[model samples]
Target: MKRHAVPAGAMLAFFLTLTGWPQCASAATPDGAALSALWGLPFAGVLLSIAVFPLIAPAFWHHHFGKVAAAWALAFLVPFAFFFGANVAFGTLVHALLEEYVPFIVLLTALYTVAGGICVRGNLQGTPRLNTGILALGTLIASIMGTTGAAMLLIRPLLRANGNRQHVVHVVVFFIFLVANAGGSLSPLGDPPLFLGFLQGVSFFWTTVHLALPMLFVCVVLLGGFYALDSYYFYRREEARSRFVESTPDSASFGIDGTVNFVLLAAVIALVLMSGLWKPGVEFDVFGTHVALQNVVRDVALIAVTLLSLVLTPRAARAGNDFNWAPIEEVAKLFAGIFVTIAPVIVILRAGEGGAFAGIVHLVNTPSGEPHDAMYFWATGLLSSFLDNAPTYLVFFNLAGGEAQKLMTTGATTLAAISAGAVFMGANSYIGNAPNFMVKAIAESRGVRMPSFFAYLGWSSAVLLPLFVVTGWLFF
Candidate 1:
């Protein structure tokens, strides 16, 4: 893949905006109530570009996606700076970058770098049982190593196992549904949204205790469905071939290279936990955004961890995994636009009952002023399918009365719905979660004909939407 160069003019303008104004003395943030719905168009534009461009013009999109993302970002920022003062615009940009985007890309970098180093060695048949087993195992570890980590660690092996098979798209689709999204519901360490919840005072084990039943239901249904579907295709292919023989020796034992990465993975998890647990109350204000000491430590430590993995892991291991920086670079650039354009949308949602989208706020409340659990689930979910789930989760978290203790107790069901929705429904679209896109990119790079964006949406709507309905009926 060719790297897109950042234009000199854009870089100059961005820096000028950043240093154009002094920091405000007060901590007052941007008021969503003052903004118009038109502020959200840039966000919609970027999303539309992501959805439509690759399908219509593959070569152009492949070569220029980063530039396109930057263009959309500037579209929002320029107007924002004009309408709202440069001070507000610059502060918002800094907050989005320092507080949200930086940490997000850092953690993803650590997971991707470390996981890419640990190559699974051995060849196996792509039998129905074997493929299903890999999915199950990946799902199991997703919460521990994060959905990104587990997906990076296992996807290559799964693809190689099915290299000789036709009708393998469903395998990768189910992998995204299970391993990349649904599997990370149990722990804050598992998903970005949940980790944000943890940082907001929700206990580490709260998701484990509350979301267990819902996660199990989705996993069991998806796993069973995958087995049956894979079996049907497997037999069909076998009938066509007349005989399906193992391509590699049965005696070739399975093992893992780059075992040191496992320790690095654990260190990544610990650094996350440490940031959440060890609050020194020391913070530096960078352009009006509060940068905490512990968070800075954690981000720095994670960077070191990523560099160590690159140094310690053998070059052969990464080559065997076909690891390249393209996926991470694509994620970083695209999500930078997402994180920026999404600011006004989040603020509007946060303005509940007084902001531009008060209708949405009303939908989640009943006539008696009580919380509607079902609406919370669907609203959080549908938006999460398109927006970044972490901020989407935070939006509903505040809407549900932002008290962690109360949310964990009296508002427990509402919290679960929001959490489950943000985590699980991320599978509803390719861009719903970071790992979903990475997994798709990796599979396609390996020659798997993954579904198109809308086609994948059709799959999720047909398969996952029904399951979600049943879950709402039974649990919510």
Candidate 2:
């Protein structure tokens, strides 16, 4: 059966924004208790999620929940190996440092929210860019706006511009590679992995300088080769159509909307930045629950803005663009299916120390067999693509530091690389990240064809792999 296409950018943008919660507290030494608690929640959540799935629905074994639960749990727990590997070193830091993982999650959520609001606003008219131009600039825009935002913003125009052609699936597939993943590597707002790094200490400016080269490399390859392929498809499509009555189909009347949505999108992003930048030395209770002002304010604002956008957006605008709630709901459904089931597995994995599974990364790990984050980046990424990027990101983030003396040097840098890889490439597979499916769902609505899970990955392995290998060399 043909699967759905959702905006990879919108979901990613929403999720990243949700996670971009700022740290309101001053720098305090992290103690193991807080870090332990952060690690334990997913571990426990995964366990509970799994234990209840079969209990709740034993007859539902063949569904996405049952199977994804098992896989999610596995991916969730993989972080513990890093925790355990660094157990000895972490033993000292956990008891001492203030250990703040919340910041990471908040930043991620914030980014996603911003992307979703902007991208989901409306559709665009067709532009006159050639295939190569579209691939290059389109993917670059994908990074800043978000692969979801870029895809959401561009996919329709690209499709409409090529509406006269056939066999356009390959073009969309390659777009998924460049626009979806590789493009969003620069900032935390651009991609989740980089956001984790921002909180962890890699400066936002540094990431751009480091990642720009790799991003350019991939855009070139996808645009260059895919142009050739797209041209062939265009020719064949034209030829096929010519055999019939060569009639031009009706096109969009440059139906552009959503200017306020862009503003709303900006406001949400401002809130995210505010949350990240606003911190207080004070803690509080709101009606009997312990809460940080930063967390409560940011979360509340995000929800409010999201609701307001929906209510305020003209129905005519949405309908004109064929907008509906199904894409978001579908994302919610598939993702919830994943979250409910992967609870236990992540719990188990979130408990260990760094290097717990360092041994598993001997092949294609590191530049020269040295302990490298690139290894963890691709490894965690492979699972992250099929699993949820959140826990996958956390496991690898925790894996970056606190290893034994033998692996101490450059571990932080390696961690950053792994962080980028998992978050970035997790979007490589349809089931890997949430936004990939969003694009599929949306494309289907517009009468565009999307690939199956395995089919999508084939494009990634063939097109994105070489580019990322360069990313490893250039960025890591």
Which one is best on lDDT?
1
For model 1, residues 167-222, the per-residue Cα lDDT tens digits are: 88999999999999999999887887887787678988899999999999999999
Best by TM-score: 1
lDDT of 1 at 262: 95
For model 2, how does the per-residue alpha-carbon lDDT over 1-476 read when each residue is reduced to its tens digit?
A: 23233332344334544665112111122233224334444434543443355446645732555355445544533564345432322222221111223343333343344344332222232222354566677567654655555665565556655565556677677666666666776655565555544444454455566556655665676677876776565555456434422222553343445556677667755765675567663444211123446645766776776666666666655554555555444444444334433333333333332322433434434546455566666777775665556556655554443232312234545655565666567657765554565567667666776766566678878776777777776666
- TM-score for every candidate vs. truth? 0.92, 0.66
* Model 1 deviation from native, Cα RMSD in Å: 6.0
